[model samples]
Target: MKQSEIKNLSLEDLRDKLAESQKQLTDMRMAHAITPLENPLQLRAARKVVARLLTAITEREQESLVENGK
Candidate 1:
C-alpha cells in the first residue's frame, strides 16, 4: 500500500491493517522456510509494508499524545 493511502486511513483502520500485515509476514516466512516461494520478493515487500504500517501507527499515537499533552 502507498504511504498516501495509509495516511488517509483512520487509527482503527491502521491498527487492523497492521495486524493483518504482521500475520501475512509471519505466514510468508513459515511458507518460505518450508519451501521457497516462487517469488521470494513477496517476503521483502511484506516486511517493508509492516514497517511502514508500524511507523505510521507510532507517529499517529505520538501526535495524539502531544495534542492531548499526555
Candidate 2:
C-alpha cells in the first residue's frame, strides 16, 4: 500500500491491516524457507509494508499523546 493510502486509514483499520500483513509475512517466510519463491522481491515488499504500517501507527499514537498533553 502507498503511504497516502496508509495515512488515510482510520486507527482501527490500521491495526487490522497490520495484523493481517504480519501474518502474511510470517507465512511467506515459512514458505520461502521450504521452497524458493518465484519472486523473492515479494518478501522485501511485504517487509516494507509492515514498516510503513508501524510508522503510521506510531505517528498517530504520538499525535494523540501530544494532544492529550496539551
Candidate 3:
C-alpha cells in the first residue's frame, strides 16, 4: 500500500488495515520459519508497510490533539 493511499483513509479504516496487515505479517513470518518462503524479502517489505501505517496513524492522532488543544 502506498503512503498517499493510506493518508486518504480515515482513522478507523487505518486501524482496521493495521490490524489486518499485522496479522498477515505474522503469518508470513511463521510460515517462513517452518520452511523458506519463495520470497523471503516479503517480510521486510511488510514490516516497512506496517511502519508507514503506524506513522500515519500517529501523525493523524497528533493533529487531532493539536486541533483540540489537548
Q: RMSD of each candidate?
A: 1.1, 0.5, 1.0
Instruction: List runs of model 3 lying over 4 Å from the truth.
Output: none
- Give me the runs in candidate 2 sitting further than 4 Å from their true place: none
Query: What is the lDDT of every predicted structure here?
Result: 0.95, 0.97, 0.95
Best prediction by TM-score: 2
Number of residue pairs clashing in candidate 1, backbone atoms closer than 3 angstroms, sequence gap of 3 or more or interchain? 0
lDDT of 1 by residue, 4-67 (tens): 9999999999999999999999999999999999999999999999999999999999999999
lDDT of 2 by residue, 1-70 (tens): 9999998999889999999999999999999999989999999999999999999999999999999999
TM-score (all chains, Cα) for each model: 0.95, 0.98, 0.96
Candidate 1 has an lDDT of 0.95
Instruction: Score candidate 2 by TM-score against the native.
Output: 0.98
Question: Number of clashes in every candidate structure?
Answer: 0, 0, 0
The positional error of residue 64 in candidate 3, measured at the CA in angstroms, is 0.4
Better of 1 and 2 by TM-score: 2
